[model samples]
Target: MNEVKLIDMLSYLEPELLEDDYIEKDMNKLKNLISKISESSSLITFNKGLRSIIKIITFIIASLLVLVGIIVIIIKKKKPKITKKAFNFVTN
Candidate 1:
């Protein structure tokens, strides 16, 4: 059996967005939280550490997700088939 995620199908529509690249929603909030944590932690300096790198990566991903979602939504809305023929074929 071959299973593909919704994101996988959407990636095909975008030439720049690869299937391997996952951009999550609500990531902006999470990025802000990470920044706050980094700032509050004296032991961890995000300015010149791995945390900074992670923050930047997250910000990029979040931006991408938002952009893709908006573009796709404006294009069209996706929904499952609900006709009797569709159900009959599934039961067969």
Candidate 2:
């Protein structure tokens, strides 16, 4: 048997991606996806869906902030009442 070193021809762990048809297959899939995305109505629908998702998230975050602000205001108002009573007792 010839003890020839197949340095560039064989890899023990990595698959030979550059020499195979996998790239062509992947490119074809990408091309198909791009073509679908290029259609006017599909593009509009994608944009609309993305915008609605963003709007929904923004609305939820704003509602949460308002809720938290209301809770904080209620707690602060109660604290001032308790402090006022303590001061009145000290004055007497």
Candidate 3:
């Protein structure tokens, strides 16, 4: 019922029920599959990082463009002031 008793029972029966060659082959297969999964997970993580970087860069560029546009509009809407001269010449 307990973990230790279960393990002891399995250990006592393992040699009679299981073959060493089959166990070794299965362990090797499991190791190879685990290695492949690890490699794929790393690649997926890298891709996620690249995507976030791209999004941040895009957001920064868009904000800058919006700021520049607002500045341009403000500059274009301003009109130059005109002043009259104190002394005016008579027309010929």
Candidate 4:
């Protein structure tokens, strides 16, 4: 019996194994795997986008702060210094 089964099995060994019925049986598993991968990829993309926006916003804010600091320094330097006596006299 074993010899007969082996001989029968060997007869169809050269054919391709990817038939429609085999795929249909595992369709649910394949769909679940695809959905999981798609969700993960979307999450990765969202994270990257969020990071990029945050970096851009940080750079802009830093640039604005530097510009404001430089402007403040320039204005302070342009202003004349008053003596302590003058300050006291003005206050009094």
Cα lDDT, all candidates: 0.72, 0.86, 0.81, 0.86
- Give lDDT tens digits, candidate 3, residues 1-92: 99999998887785657765887998999999999999999999999999999999999999999999999877666422111222233221
* RMSD over all Cα atoms, model 4: 6.7
**What tens-digit string does per-residue lDDT give for candidate 1 at 1-92?**
23577657666687655545355545767898898887778455544588788889999999999999998886554323345558779899
Q: Which stretches of candidate 3 lie over 4 Å from their true place?
A: 1-20, 79-92
- Over 4 Å off, model 1: 1-48, 77-92
Candidate 4 yields a Cα-based lDDT of 0.86
Clashing pairs in 3: none
For every model shown, what is its TM-score relative to the native structure? 0.32, 0.47, 0.60, 0.64
Q: Please give, for residues 3-79, the per-residue lDDT of candidate 2 as tens digits.
A: 45565445553765456888799999999888877897788988999999999999999999999999999999899
Model 2 Cα shift for residue 23 (angstroms): 33
- Higher TM-score: candidate 3 or 4? 4
Candidate 4 lDDT by residue in tens digits, 17-86: 5344776768988999999999999999999999999999999999999999999998777655545557
lDDT score for residue 5 of model 4: 96
State how far residue 69 of model 2 sits from its true place (Å).
Answer: 0.8
When superposed on Cα atoms, how far off is each prediction in RMSD? 36.0, 14.8, 7.0, 6.7
Winner of 1 and 2 under TM-score: 2
